[model samples]
Structures are given as structure tokens and as C-alpha cells.
Target: MNRDSIFISHATPQDNEFSIWLTSRLEMLGYKVWIDKEGLLGGERFWVTIQQAIQSSAKVLFVYSKNIVTNEGILKQGIENEIEYAKSIALQFHIQDYIIPLHIDDSPYNLAIGLPNINHIPFNNNWAEGLKILKKKLEKDSIPQIFDTSKSVMAEWYENEYISNCSIIPKTELFYTSWWSVSDLPKEFYMYQFSNEVQAKAIRNSNQTIPVSLMSNVLSTFDAKLSFVVNRDDENIELKPVHTYIYSLNDILYGFESDKFPQHRDVENHFKRLLYRVVSNFLIYKGLWRNEMSNKRLAYFLPKYEKIKKIDFTYPYSNRKKSKSILGKFESIGMWHYAVSIQPMLFPFVGFSLKSHILFTSDGFKIIDDDKKQHSYRRKKGKRFFNEEWRDLLLAFLQRLKDDNEEIKIKVSQEGLVMKMKEWPEMFWSEVGYNDPNSKMDLDKIEDYYEEITEESND
Candidate 1:
């Protein structure tokens, strides 16, 4: 997009695969990204070409690698080139310091803390988010300036088909997904299509032209999402609907009580929807691991119910996976009303006696009991109460609800049970239908690709 080109300073032997992947993605995005693979190919003086590109470019991107710090290759390449270029250009041109370094979470760019003024984005969590960071960086008006000797670097780059301006950081393959925040997407509208990493880029760019395909033109199929949201104002995950669900907090914890008013606007029905959701989701996960059945393409699961709770305030980056099993159970019930557990542990509907007990549990939770009254449950023992008889359980619960309050209007929506993925990236990454031959990609299309994925083997 720019007149200037980017030089990718990277280690050769160690990061060969990553370098290849980064170049392809950048090219697809229509950016001129320079890497050693494209630039230092021929017998042309290696140092001369490197210095020329550094001189002309508006930007220099260091795909910082641990290997780069340790190994040395031709013409002081990798991190060294990136740093040298930054110093030379910044001092001469009045540039705003466009020398950028990207790194994984563990390694902060400064060789020493609080130094290097090195601005980098975290690539550990999500690939799409990381790409977002780099795109903004490249577009900034504050790019480092050009040097005099670098005057014709841009011209030389184009003449030799050299990449310029943008350089992809290493490790893009592991973390990126086609999914992104709703507001972050390029097109306001997109279609529904099932995709994996190899073809995810194709799905994203399919919307660029009008006559993409039948599926691309259909409409967005993102789902309601479940994530630990730091900012409540994120576009895909809005707070307004959450606020509505939060208002129903009282009924969810205790029990739906009927009143002269709206009775939580039908809390029990909502609860039933949530329960169906949970059961179906559990099945989906089990199914994924056991069979090659493909999950239906679905849109983001926007929180229809927002839950507000007293905060126990469990920050993430802590071990919370075990408890997620129980929390997932709640989500299945469709109780989207989310809450941060004020206590480290909470058992919903707790009962030592047979009267009442917590039915749902999740990871990262604490139980809060402000009221000291212990709930004791007692019922007529029916010799007829059989485990296999589901009707009995249904009748008993219905009778209990009826007795609790006649005003309580309970109507579970009759909508067919539709279960999308119950888990996040883990579930998405887990291979499903790979064993099934039908799940493979079209053979004709695979032949058309420059490099098809391992999906062909599965077919």
C-alpha cells in the first residue's frame, strides 16, 4: 500500500517454516513484506541489498526470535539488522521511531527491563488480535523517517520484486483464528462458512469482491461467545443485553418465585432453555472426540442473559480449567447472566438435607450464603419412584414449582435443542470428523492450491 518497503530481519535456519508462513499471509493482505527469503536470493552483494532496503524503507520490522539473539548469519541479518536500521534512520530523518519489535509473552523486548522503548504486541493469546496490533502500527503516521543513502531503496525493491514496509512476526500459525471481534472485521457484512487455519484467510478475503460465492454472500454465521471480557464495551460482546440478564440474578440463584408482577419475565422457561443448552453441549464435545461428525456452522453466541454478581474477582492466568466443567453446565442451561464469584467456592442451591442443593457448578467460583437458614428437603417416598422413569422427575419438579407459587409462570421455549461448541479455542482445535472420509476437503480444490493442508490425508 505504501511507496516504501519493509525488510524482515530474521534467522535463516531455525525459523524457516515461520518465515515462509508469514510471507504468504502478508502477501495475501496486499502488503509488501520483506524477508531474507525474497531479498537475499542471488549473488548480488548481500550487504549492499540489505543496506539499500533499510535506507529507503518507511518501516523496519524485526520478527524477533530467540534464535536471532544467539545465531549469526550473512550480513548481520535478523534482530541486528532491524536494530541498526532503526538507529541510522531515526537520527537522520525526523521519523517518529517506526522500529518495532514483536515478541511472545514471556520475552519482553528490552534486553533489560524498562529500556529499548520497544513497542510490541502479544501474540500468545489470539492471532487475530495480534494482526490487529501490527496493522495499526504499520498505518500510524508516526513511522521512522527515511535516510539519504536509502533514497532509491524503494525503487530497487520493486525492480527486484522485493518486499517492503511490513514484516510478519514469527509464530503466526499457532494462535490465529479466522474469528475476530465483531467490530474489528473488515466488511460490515460477511457470509457463513466452515473453515480451518489453512483456508481461514480465503474465507476472510472472500468478501472483498461482490460475487465471491453463494456461501460467502449468504450472511454472517458467527455465534454468541463465552469469554472473560476485560472491557464490557467490546462490540461483539455488548453490555446492554447483559444488564437485562443481570437483573434476573435473584431468581436464578434461589428459585423462580411468582409475584403479582412479571415474575422475572418467565425465569423458569429461560432456565429450561439453559439446561437443554448444557446437555446438548456436553454431547457435542463427547461427539467431537468420538466421531467425525461435523458441527454445524454457527454465529457467535451473544449473551442473551447478562449475569451480575458480587465479585470474588478471580483474575485469569490462574488454573481455572477444572471448574470450567461445572460452569459449562450452567451455560448449557442458557443462564448467560454471568457473575464473578465473590467467594472462592459456591454450590448453587446447597442443601445438607434432601430439600434443596446447588444443581450447577463451574470453575473459578465461591459460595456466598448471607442467609443462615439451611434448606431441608423431604418428600413422600414412592415405591413407584423409579430411576429410569423420566416422567416422574418432570412431574415432581412441576409439582414443586406449582406449590412454590401459582403465579410463577414457567414456560420453557419449545425451540429444538441446538448445541454449538461448549468450549472455546480448545473445542475448536480438537479434531472432529477427521476420521470420516466425508469431512475431507474437495480433492479438485486441493490440487488447485499452491500448498494444500494435511486435510488431504484425512480425505
Candidate 2:
């Protein structure tokens, strides 16, 4: 019974997720948080324990939500009892601002019991923003923090109680990878020499249809007859092909044994860059819009054109199959487009992995340009997505790219040079089993409860 401890009062099951999240965050910041979860033993008196905890705690965090009130705006018996008891304790101890209300939903302040007069922290729209304000308030109150042992205690609790029991099982399971396996490529790599340094520099600086890695006075490409006209101001400049070389694709895919060219590591790096360019160009050719992220990485997104507005796919939900669109327009937040960033991998397997991203547009055409706003909106929109939802979204986007074919082919040049890859890489592993505590929980019930509460509050 530490006097500095913060006690959390929340409705069971309904507000469980938010309570756990808030508790974990406070504990990580070295604040001792007491939540009524796995605390009382069987047959123990719950109200008696709660009263004792409130008496000893410095502050009580009341998670004010619609769950704590009925349709008549009357407080539930259990929470009403707890809040009344906490108020009495505060008066007896002469504690100022003893109770802090964390408004996690759209519940009206006027309908809230023992919270109308008090300042409530907002978390309905943004949890992270609410956390920042809460932290400032906690600091102002000079809440005692046990910096040394708090982190270790939190880690121990997470391992022992947070995660469920698990055991390794001798069963095979198919693991889907983001990687797309490369199946075919051109055999020869050519080094094209230009007539002059200026022409070579112009070709290197300009965007080309074929994938290439450039050096001073030389350009390395897989296409033997790679030729492009560079437009500069009022002049059209064509780089002269003065020299050529025969380089093996196997040496690039598999490790090279020859010391005649650059270092194998350098060659591998250059080839990877070329492959990335190929993918980028191919996506652009397929009418996907590109946007650069805050970290300078380029991500390609499906545009809002009628041909590919929404990608439909089926996924496992509950114990049954469910169909949904991967990308579409929402009235609340405009259009959400499925985007992906790619990285070409050469070790263990020759493949390119696609990392998924979500991009937003106001009218389903022009993308929102502000990076900070984009990031915040993305976080808010994606927070409710389950693991299966994210996986299916990525899979659906990949299927859209593959169309009806088993492979996606990118033409490297007009000389019939093409790079072909499978839709997805095949992977398998021995599965480990775990008893998920939330496996039987009904998500639909939770959603319905939230919706009901919101409607009641609005009324």
C-alpha cells in the first residue's frame, strides 16, 4: 500500500484494452500503477480491497466512459460506489485533485458522475496526445516515481502475466512472406560508353526507361541496345554508345568468381539498386502513384481511377470467411490507398520484399502533402486493424498487381529482356502453439457495445 501509487478505476471487460494500455504506459514512466486485474484472490471481498487501495493511493484515475452510465445517465452501482468512496477518502485526507478523469470515448461530461466539475483528459480522438497532456499533469502534481526498480518489475510482470502459456508443437504451417521471388532475368549485362563526359553526365542525371547504374563516362545496364534521348531546355541530347561488355547474370545473382570487374559487394549493391529502379518504373508504368515518405523512402500507391479504385479479397474472420475491400473512400476520412515500399534481397534467396503503407487523399485524387498530418491520420485509422486484417490487405493488394497471371513480368528493354517473378515467396516452418486468452472474445460484441454507448451519449 504505497501512498505514492496511482489506482485505476475502470469498468471490467468494456474498458479493459484502454486500462491496460494506460497502465503499461504509466508503469514504463516509473509510476507505480495499481489496476484491479489479477490482484484479488478467489472469494476475496472486491469492494473492501478497492476501498483499502483508494485510501492508500495518492491519486485515482477514473476511466470515464459510457460503460459506467446507463441510458438515464445514472452511474452503475459498482463504479458509483467506488467514486463516492474515493471522494470521501479525499475529503478525509484533504487531498487536492485526488481523482483524475480520463475521457476515452465520446461520453458527455454533463452525464458523468463525480467528474463534471473536474478537468478531464481527452483521449477520444488521439491516445498519444492524451498521454502527453497526462504526463504534464502528473509532473505538475509531483507524483513520486521509483526510477530504478519500476522498469524491471514491469518487464517481469509482462513476461509472467501479460503473455499466455506456450509450447512448441511438431506441426507444419505455411508462412506467407512479403518477398516476391525472381524467376527470370537476362543473361548478359552491358556497359555502354558515351562519346563525351558531358553526354554521359546528362544520361546519368536524366530518368531512363531501362534500369541502369551509372559511372563517369560509362553506364551499366542489362539491356544491350539501351538508348534514350535526354531533353535539356531546347536541345535533345542522345548519348553515343562507344563500348560494350558481356557480363553474366549468374555472377550477379549468384556470387561472382572473377576479379576483372568491381568488388563483388559493390557489384551486388549496384545490381540491387538497378532492381529497385526496375520495380519503381514498372509500378509507375502500371499507373500507381508514388509518394516519398518522411524518411525519404519512396512508396507506390494505387490511384483512385475507376479501373483500380477498390481491391476485393476474402480473409478469415472469426471462424468463417469474410470479404472486404482493401482500399476505398470513407466519408469520415476521405480515401485510403494501399501503398508499398520495396527492397530487393539477394541472400538465401533472390527476391524483392514489399513493405505495406497507407496513403490518404481528400477527394480520392490528390494526396495529402503534410507528412505529420499523414502520419497522425494513418496511426488513428490503423489502430483498430487486427493482425488478420493487415495480412489480408497486403495479400489483396498483391493479387491486384498480379491480375490473373501467376507471375508479374517487367520488360527491361525492347530486345526481349524481361524480369519475371512469382506473386509471393513460399515458406514453411514447424509451428509453435499458444493458448490465446482473447481467441474466444467476440469483437463484434465490443463494437456493438461501443456503438450503443455512442448513440446513447448523443441522445
Candidate 3:
């Protein structure tokens, strides 16, 4: 029997996914790895086999998580037995670093009783990054590898066990995207040349009123006339607007003939910046409150006003359909308000790409300013949302913005020009067969969380 094999000790079923993934990767690297996939049966013969395997192993990789221990600092019986046996073997053999702990979740290291004062490789945030560090440590420890024969064995095992579970079947699937297509847009682009730099600076400063892209003394916009009056020094200033140039949308999309913006990319970038401001202004006009992120980018969030408590929408779940509110109050973490950072895209499609964000508020009025706490709350609560949930949340938010005419229209110019988005674009793909088992589990948990919150709000 060879002592070159790497022994993997993990909590069964709960840590099986990570254990399997790690085993496959290590085996591919030509390291002989042993893992009991069926879990401990708790017999004398089983214990004897496990003890012999651990004793003859080069290093024992322990998968550490809350699954192997309780929140009250109690260790799992099977995991405790395995760790105790491995530690005894390490002491007898004088193995300096016998057990290498792989911390997969947010389980505190202090509570990991069996493996005390040992450094752990963090795989909580990113598995690939953790694997890189683990590989380097293995190489440093001079772990023996039988690359020639091990590769073939791993391929056969993977194909027989893993690939058997997945099947390639022909099916058509509809993918809901965050992209909302711009069906109609204004044709004309106006450049309002101010009298002096002072007037231009004032107009630039008050961008929320009339969205514009300022360059020197020139103010570029899609609107023919300014929506708000210009004032300076607490006095109304009568200013005359001199039209510099009226460029067509085609010129901005294709090429720019102007000397200032010579490059086509620069023209497109300028248009995108101006378009973002327009969309932000449109959201503000629609009564959505704006909150500026630390990066100086503005994110508009739905406020809990008297009229709007929750935005209702329907989404597919399991074999049936379900409806839920995109905005709600979670008892564990304040109010979860749906926020979006709209970015105007041109290459793939002429549309506004909405990036979803969650803003927290105590009473659904004032936003939580503690950045650290907000991040932690988002990680804890937002993890429950599956792809379907996120998609429907975005859909509901967009649906709420629609008028009675069933159109989301933004006024661009004073010349009655507007940009319209009828609805979200649904992309369909054929021959899709894969489905995530975890998503269904997550959806169930999230639904329960929603029910709990609803009950709390009622109380």
C-alpha cells in the first residue's frame, strides 16, 4: 500500500459537492485522492478501513464548515471521530502539517474544535482562487504525483459518475434579460452654446433639471428647449441660447463630423453619457428617489410612498407559477428596496441595460448609510434570490414605470421627441437541457423568508 494518496475528510451530503470538485481537480493533477462518497456507515470494519486510509495518506484535507459543527460550538460525531483519528496518526508519524483545513463557508475558525491553531485555505468567496493557493501549498510540500496513469483513471471515473447524471436533451428555453430595448428615439441632437463659461458651468451644475453633456461653453442635449429656468446668485438670469450645431442621431451612432469629437468611439461614448443622464432624469421625473453610490454613479430606488407599497409580478417556479412583490420589508434586515444603475449600450443592442441593486432602509424612507453593514446585509439576504427571482424583480420594477398607455416613454427634446421602451426583450434558445437543482431549493427558502416578513409586517 502506497502512502502517497491524499485523503479527503468532509461532512457527508452537505459538503459532497465541494469534495467531489476538489477530488476531480486533484486527480487530474496526478495526485491519488481517496474520498468516501457514500458517507460513514458507522461499523467496526468501516472505521478500520478509514483509520488505515488516513494513517497511510500523505496529507488529510479537512472540509470545514457549519455543517460539521453546530452554531452552539458542538462538533458532528462522525467528523470528530475522523479528525481525532487523523490527529493521532499525525502525532505518531511526526507529520508537521497533516491536516489542511479548507474553509468553505462563514463558519468561525475558533469553533472548529478538533483542528485548533491550524491555518485554513479560504474558499468562501471564490473557489478557483482558493484552489490556486491550495495547489501551491501542495507543490511546496512535495506531494507525489503519478501523472501518467492517474489522468486516465480520473477521466473514466468522471464520465461514469458525473456525466451520467447530466443528459443532453433538446428543449427550448426562454431567457429573461435585464436589457430593455429602445424601440423609438429622437432623431435630432442639439448643442446649446452659452454666452460665457460661467453660464455653461451653472447649466452643467444643475444637470438634474435638464440633462446635458457640457463641453467648454457648449451644452449638448437631445432636448430642443430647456425644461427648467436658469438662475444664478439667487436671482433669475435671462439667458439666450445660441444653437451651435444640430447633429443627427445617425452621425452620433455611426460617425462624428465635428472636430471636437473626431473619433467614432468618442462620439458613441458621449452619446452614452448623455443618455445615462437622460434616463436618470426620467426616473427622477417618475418619482423614483436617487441615491449616489460611493463610485459617484447614481442609482434610482423605489420609495415606499403611500401609493406604492409593493410592485407585484408573476414568475415561473418549479412546475407551477407564483407571484411576489419585488419590494418588501425583511425583519432580519430592514427594507429591501430595488435600485437600478441604468447604462446605455449600443453595440449588442440599442437599449438601456439595468443593473439591479438593493438599497436598505429602516422605515422605508431614509436609506442606510453604513456601507459595511449594508454589504453584509445584502450578502446575507440577497443570496436567497435565484435567477428567476432577480429577473422577475427587474421585470416588476420596469412594469411599474409604465404609463396607462402601456409604454415607458422618456421625453428627450422640447420638439415632442421621446424614447420609448415597450417591454423587456425575451431571448429564446433551443436545445437547452441543464437545470440547477440548488435554484429550486433557494426559491423555496426565499418564499418562506417572504412569508415570515409578511407576517411580521402584519403584526
Full-model lDDT for every candidate: 0.34, 0.70, 0.71
Tens-place lDDT per residue, model 3, 164-183, is 55545567766776676778
Clashing pairs in 2: none
Cα lDDT tens digits for candidate 1, 1-459: 243666566655554434444444344444565566443343333666677777766666665545555433333443565567567776788666456665533444545222257666654343334555765576565443232433333335433442222223333122211121111111111223233332323432432322122221121211222121223345332211111122232444455556642244444333333333332233233221111111322211112122322212121243532211111223322221111111111133211111111221122232222121111000111212232222222222222222123321212112221222211111122222221112111111112222322232134
* Candidate 2 TM-score to native: 0.76
Residue 309 local lDDT, model 2? 43
Q: How close to the true structure is residue 173 of candidate 1, measured as C-alpha lDDT?
A: 28
> In candidate 2, how many Å is residue 381 off?
3.7
Error of 3 at 101 (Å): 3.4
Query: What is the alpha-carbon lDDT for the whole of candidate 3?
Result: 0.71
TM-score of each: 0.31, 0.76, 0.72
Each model's Cα RMSD: 24.9, 8.0, 9.3
